[model samples]
Target: MARGLIKAKMLPEGKEVEFEVEKPVKVSDLLKMAGLSSETAVVIRDGTPLLETDVVKPGERVEIVRVLSGGAKV
Candidate 1:
């Protein structure tokens, strides 16, 4: 991990990316920085799903999982 950067790993693809966070940043904003939508993907930290409003700090680690919809018709 780079010094003073938020590290996040993308699920399925297992691609790792880093973001420079000078201050606390919202999960949704991080998702946007990764070119993803909160509705389409979820941010996870320490194996816990985080809310869009949840704040992530610099030097923190997270994972982004793409949500797949359209399973058995309800």
Candidate 2:
């Protein structure tokens, strides 16, 4: 089984966390393992947006970030 590192910026606290997991795991799975919510975060692989069903390959760096909402009322 292939393995790689996944790093993410957790919301609320805004702290970064890193972990290693087997390759081919869904983005959802990565979120679960990283202790993040799938609804609030976006997964990116090698600077490309990856779907939850996308498989992460070995040696690939993944960044899961929480989407921030902000707006100015007109």
Candidates' lDDT values, in order?
0.89, 0.72
What is the C-alpha lDDT profile of model 1 across 9-35, one tens digit per residue?
Answer: 998689999998778889999999889
Worst 10 residues of 2 by lDDT: 5-14
Candidate 2's C-alpha runs over 4 A off are: 7-16, 70-74
Q: Evaluate residue 8 in candidate 2 and report its C-alpha lDDT on the 0 to 100 scale.
A: 63
What is the alpha-carbon RMSD of candidate 2 to the true structure? 3.5
lDDT of 1: 0.89
TM-score of each prediction: 0.84, 0.64
Q: Top model by TM-score, which number? A: 1
lDDT of 2 by residue, 1-74 (tens): 65766666555456777767776678888878876688888788657888888876545566778776666657
